[model samples]
Target: MTFHKEDQVLYLMAEHDLATLDTVGLKKDFRTGYDSGVYRITHKQWGEPPHYAQAYFDENKHLLLFSAMTDRGFEQLVEAFNAFGHDFPAEPYLRVNLTMVTTANEILKKKVVLNEYHDLFQEDPDPESEKVLKEINAFIALVLPDINAGRTPGIEAAIRKSGIDPENARNVMESVMGSLEGLPGPKGKSPRKSPGKSPVSGKQKKLTKQLPAQSGEGVRLLSGDDELLFDLHLYGMAGDIRREAPWEYLFEDEVFGVQVPGKDLVYFVSVMGFEGEHQALSFYKGYEGLAGFLEFRAEVGRLSLLGLPDDGMLQASTMTGGLMTIPHLMLSFTDRDDLEKEDLAAIKKSGARFRGKGQWPRIEEIVPGHVPVYPSKDSLTELFLVVQQVLVVLEKDRYDDQYLMREEDPDHTILVRVPTGKGPRFRWRDHYLVVDPKWGETSYAVRISPASSVALARLPEASQELQLDLFMLPATVREKGSRAYFPFVLMMVEKLNGLVVSMSVLSPQPDLESLYESVPQRVLEELIKSGHRPSRIEIRSDLLFDLLEEILEKAGCRVMWVDHMLQMDEAIMSMISHLS
Candidate 1:
């Protein structure tokens, strides 16, 4: 019923004001270079009654009532809304909660649902429009509690419920209740006066020229799509942000990308609206004279990135520890005393030390190690090979022995934020993840997974030592789908700058020739169970590269066939089509 009367006259002067209303704080509102118009929701699994969330209005609702939540995210959003329905217990004096604003992130991503237009009020198919729609729903419950008591809606109940007489009910609510007699007559006063100024002095000079004298905030350039164009505006403290979750920051790219090495300058990066989780912000643009830096750190309430990439050019600073503490798991780890020492050196150097300690590590906030627990498919493939040996010991203990000894001399470049995940989520703070290493190079831990979890993680052929590879085999039966998905998937890149290096799964097939008849004895038994001996194998396919080169040339195994792996099979089929 048409509201926003300046937010119901300051919520009725916040009930006899002395001013107060708290709760709002759950940060991590999405950001990727540009374009924004947030407020998105839909996280329902149960807890009935309109709860899908982000309903500044509604698309789907179960019980989110967000008007900017935060009593520690409403006690974890009411215990994830009573454990998504069916744990009963809800009438505690009919709690109504409707305040908003919440953002907080250590990666809890699930966005991409924008489409809001709703205005439909049609219902006039005459036969006297159902008593003029129950006299406009009884004049909207008698003018919605008199709009904070300024009072209006009473032409004797709109002429006895629209039978319309008193001069057609004063010309039908004087053309539909003409602006409820111009609002504000209750507590927070000041109804008229603007004809010569004073009534809220033009909204206090447009909110003091949209706040920010020392209030602070930024982000400029709004409009893009050419050199990857632009569009941004968090705006001076983004107007003291009250509600706008989905935030993100790694470097928001050193302020949003500013590449000038071969000059065309084209600036990018100037947005700020991070509302705390301690603090750690990043930016560094130098290969040498792409030269720029800007880091911010704070401790205890953790935010560390203690600068270096030769912490040399341009500036801005803050300090504690150079932020790098990566841990990412997307469901299932059941328990191995929450492993750590680089997650037990990525599970005994990627051989998945369930035999040692990794069958259940990460015990953050005490026990709940990842989720979607196991029930069988051989216990989720023996806990997905002990979480694929904790992502090959988190990509071989991701750099920092002084950036791997400043990337071993010869033209160095390092920008890191690794603990990546796509398909079970974890993005560890993504600072444009670029790691350059060309002097006697070494970096390969890639995994593509699904060939029935690398055929129940084969290996044990015993000859293992090949290691420096890039593999992809699933070519079709629609990019290989069933055996409940495991028609070959493998990736491990380090031709040097190919980047990404870890993911696992390959051992479930009911066809596609038992998944290409065991890709050359399950990649020579998973490089003899990852003791990785690949001085050769480089395969990439355009329709299973001639039957994976006559099945790894009849298993003698020193394979080769990377005709630019048709751009890594269309970049892993466009990241499995934006992660399906």
Candidate 2:
């Protein structure tokens, strides 16, 4: 067997040999890379040159060494192998390895090459050899595409003459090319345009759909008098409550074609009075004596009013039978004293009680006359200060009367727009600052110059420092179902000239990405808490893809193959052209 193997190796070497060295000008062959007949070492050791000093390869895949080379040359040879080995194929391109071993000083360092036995590896004894083969196969697929295409004919002829399946060889080459074609790019896919329409339209639709309806449906608490105004003294027994104590008239415009009633919702009323030059009123004062009377606390999450409806029954709250009963149930006051007393009593006499307080007695018998309003000590002063730290209040209404004109409220009321997420803080002159909770700051100051207020009547005396208190929290709903708590800041800005302005620093908590991930969980929690939850709005999968594309573009990335991605995310395909 050993002799037979030796003979086979010898035969293979003889088949690939071209003994006579042909020293001549440069020659080229399409099959092999470069074939210059002459072999010369431009820089080698300063000694007698070898008779033959060139790389020799055999058909058996064995390599032979020869040459009078220098140490530096050998180092270059090793380095070349390493650099090429990154994506080198197991089966040598030329079927052999070449080396130059020096005998002058018994030093083998001139060049060293170990001919890797490709055929022998096929019959390997070690189990790990299979893994190595797989890796080499994968490598070949990665790096030999252009070479395979160029040498297809020679490789095919070799396989056929060797009685090997030429088709398998072709298959291997194709596989390598295919694998190389599938590598990923840095930017996965480009932004795509929608099929039938532009992405801008789709994006606009998506934005619109994502938002709550432009028209809102909320009830207002307005007085029944000719002026439709709320009066504290009028409602009080001592004098006209509008001037004596304090009151507020709420009005619902029925925007978006929805009627919102004032009585359906409970309002924690408070009165603010000037204690000298400074505006001084406790948060508890805002709640009136209701804080102690109704056992209210400073904690301002959602309040579970006892009489809210789970269904669309809030319409009845305005008609007088719904949650409005809560006040009478608690205070036990006569309806005759209320601003809505006559109208309310007529409704009550008409025979109707929205599931009467199963435990409480008739309100008329419990107590009589108007529910007296008392002042409560402010307990949320610290919380208010915390809010003031991050926001700037521009216009603060300081009215001595308990009930100020509602019409006047809009003109003098402070307007504040809180930021939604973790974002930067910017200032607009004369506008109040709205702090984003994610910013972690207590307050942000804004300077309103009178120059900017020329459009309005005139600048208030120079600039006034308006202290703000943030009470609103950031929240979002993806459709109607996905409600997320975004970090937000709340504060009132004083209106300087004529513009109602407020600035908010962007601070996103539970960012948009996280909100989408936990949409379902958040929706369920919000639903249970609100009891009167809004209807859910469903969105197409394509909308998400479109949004992603817009966000990526905004983040500054090159988009490619957008059309293909659009096809995959069909819903958003229509939004491919949208720039933002």
Candidate 3:
């Protein structure tokens, strides 16, 4: 069932008499003390791993609870809190958490029940949620009765009833009671298993280097060698290595580093343990991911020093700059249908399982100059080789020292293994990584035809200088079983008054190169059709400059590359907003 932002379920602790002024402080203390920070809740009872929730005291003193596992549930909570402060309305919360309401009859029953506070509103709650809820009810039931008897409400037994260990339960109770007396309590122990070394050591010690050759400027042509392109042996080896070293043994912050021999570029590998949403070996190319990671760490440190809660610090860090923007090639584990037809066929041919909804291997090539797409067979082979190397390093514990590189480490040096030769030989290279703000612009070579120059020369020169930009729209179009691509738009606007002279939607059919190669002709044809050539054309993108430079210069139109085009940016934003 679809859960909308405007649907909510409220549960009131009817067994407790929490209407008194003293109850306000008690509720506040409970919320603050028991608060499990976002993404850090280790309790198995609090929803699922990674996506969990903490209880809060709303303005009305109701126990506010929600789970991130529900569709748009987290977003709804954020929106409600933002709009109405602490007294947020309950209309926008999910009426039935599918995780809780399992049976058809329970769903039907919940559909008729009004969304109001009640002691026993939730029926057939998931085992984990039910256990936790019972514990919460027990604590609330004890609060008032024990206080009236002039005794402190000890909640260790209640916490233990929820399956927490005795020590942790005591710690939780101490934290809660200490808050009442304005004393600092010890942090609760997390239930997650500590990071451990891989059980099996990888035997492979060297990388097979059949690197792709550079194709002119800003492009690399894949090698034609059969061994380099989809080597089944390499794929099998990588898979075996991965099977040996499960991601659960490593933390998200742990990076397995690799560097291509003779190249300055480095790729940091992050093995996601499936503890969070993603299950993949993410190869964050270049310095982008490293920079983002360091920045995020620094932000967290700064926020922690200021005494902010984990969620608040994370939210603030995310708002300023998040690591999600880093460009990385992810070797994801996903269902078969999520794979492109070609990718699925490749897997099938390799005798890999592809029929069921299992976490199959899929390569997501998200790099510079291209839209996110499934890698070709050749590219997939290359990526699998990298994955193999990373797994090997992970198994051998070669990256253990690199994992120790902290914020206080003066050098910030990354240990990268450089492949020396094919016979189990490699060299360790030390590279100090830093954030490079300058982004690598994708450039395409465009040849101007004499016929096009003749046609542009025939048009009369217009007084106005026009701004031209060829950019990918935010929206994407895709066919079933095929990879998705952003639609490109060739927009021409009058630089003076922001009047749109021409706009044409260009499809990245065949490939992006073909689309880029057609841009010069398209722009020229538009100018000729308009019967007037502008004196000068202003372009912000390096790509547009590259495509239009030779053609526009031959047409007696000066091409200027400026940092910003107000008209073009505004028009792009408007179109994007409209599409969104």
Candidate 4:
């Protein structure tokens, strides 16, 4: 109706009347006769941009019964809905639908009121907006007949016709159907609604419970030798690497290589410190070859630009020679709880400079098999030892032949030093780390396993179903003198009613692996404690699905990966507001 020109004008004129209508009355009049959930519809006109509209019913409030037009308007409406759970201050929220602009007063109100409306096209019209509005109007006209007849709209076909990807079109239709589930079909004929089923529920293929065997071949594991390498790193190796293999002499594009004796692999290292730049050594697996190095180089270039301080005292001080810019590798860790006393002492003695409130430097090791982590004392020591070995190779003249070869063929080969054995008698042999000359020849893969499969098996299946989500909160938490980090939350809510069943917050301190590995067990504990095994669990995150799939399936629970979880999202937004 609002799409009609005369109705649109009338709606604008009746803003006061609409505002005067209580939320209950408005719901009774405008309700879509569907369960509470977000429904999206897209309209596209010939030779015009697409416009989107989303309508939702709020389970927690009386208002939130209106439809939003355009992507920006939809986003604003969602934000306002989220703000309703908290004691957010009242504010005016504006939305532009087609040519009409409406402002809502007390946007945080449980029952929202439209303050006023105006014709945007009449006063300072934007050509782009007008064009988009026209397209939206055309799309509305196309779908109005189906909507009035209570028939499912041909949204997917329309989307496909508009040149959208078939898969994306199917996803859009899935959302629409999921939201329209249990609603009446043609001629007000009610569809068969499954008892206790969620409004957003949909049929999903059952996932296999048995996990594939993880291969250990070609995978590097942390061993005692690795510990030895980290120990070598702690004995002033970073400074030695900087002095012996300066990036000024060895360009970032040139690779300095290292290989341990009796090992089948070689590591290609790039030194980055070259005055007014990040001081760090980036290592790439030799198996990855030339393209991998190029990719790493490109990522480093992007990081360098992104790492620049924003408009702040740090930027001003750096410009005025009052502060030093430290590499992100040397992140500050003022909290002693984050580090062992011995490691802290070693770091302090290592002569590493730190700024801000952090008293010691922490090394962040990002390797092939593990999550980015602040390495433990032994691990840090091993890394430093490897750096010391690299420094030794750079300083020695025995590797001159390999270095010369690498210099001549920079793209194909790298200078490498292989150690014979550990201990004081360790001897070095010069060699070249060679790779396939062609690009895209190598692939890097890492296998992750659920932390606790046993706990998953012990979970008792229940009759109820639930929506689950694990996400990092936007708000950060930190101790008085420590670096800040966003905390993660694992939440499970009753799928049908949107009631929060369980919520667990985890801190990713020391390393991300610790946090990641702890998730499965936490989910199991929460489910067992709450006495809800959930016959079916729906989730949107690939990470959560990966972590919980095998385990949950073993417990006789089906896992469904969907495009959206209405209840889960709303709950998360409320949690975020409280946290913020």
Q: Name the lDDT value of residue 502 in candidate 2.
A: 30
lDDT of each: 0.28, 0.23, 0.50, 0.45
The most accurate candidate by lDDT is 3
TM-score ranking, best first: 3, 4, 1, 2
Candidate 4: misplaced stretches above 4 Å?
1-237, 240-279, 282-381, 392-417, 422-425, 429-488, 493-501, 506-547, 554-556, 561-580
Each prediction's RMSD over C-alphas, in Å, is: 24.9, 37.2, 22.8, 32.3
For model 3, the stretches where C-alpha displacement exceeds 4 angstroms are 1-328, 332-362, 366-381, 388-415, 420-445, 475-484
Which candidate model has the greater TM-score, 1 or 4?
A: 4
Off by over 4 Å in 2: 1-125, 131-151, 154-171, 179-492, 497-507, 513-580
By lDDT, rank the candidates, best first.
3, 4, 1, 2
Clashes of each: 76, 46, 2, 10
Put down candidate 3 lDDT per residue, 1-580, tens digits, no spaces. Answer: 2122353322211111123222233332223232222111112233332233333333355344433544334444434333433444433223332212222112123232222322222335456545543544344444536644658766565455455334434433433332222211133111222347742234322222222222223322222111212333333443453454456576666665666443445567777764755677777776665655555565566656766444444333222223433456776666867778766766654433333444566767763333566665444544654664565565445435433243344243343544443321233433333323442344566655678789888788879789887766656677675556566778899999998999998876666667778888888788887888898899855556867787789887889987456677677667766977
Clash pairs of candidate 4?
A: 229-382, 230-381, 230-382, 230-383, 231-381, 231-382, 232-384, 232-385, 233-384, 233-385
Taking all chains together, each candidate's TM-score versus the true structure is 0.19, 0.15, 0.40, 0.31
TM-score, cand. 1 vs. native: 0.19
Give me the displacement of residue 488 in model 1, in angstroms. 6.6
RMSD of candidate 1 to the truth, in angstroms, is 24.9
Clashes of 2: 46
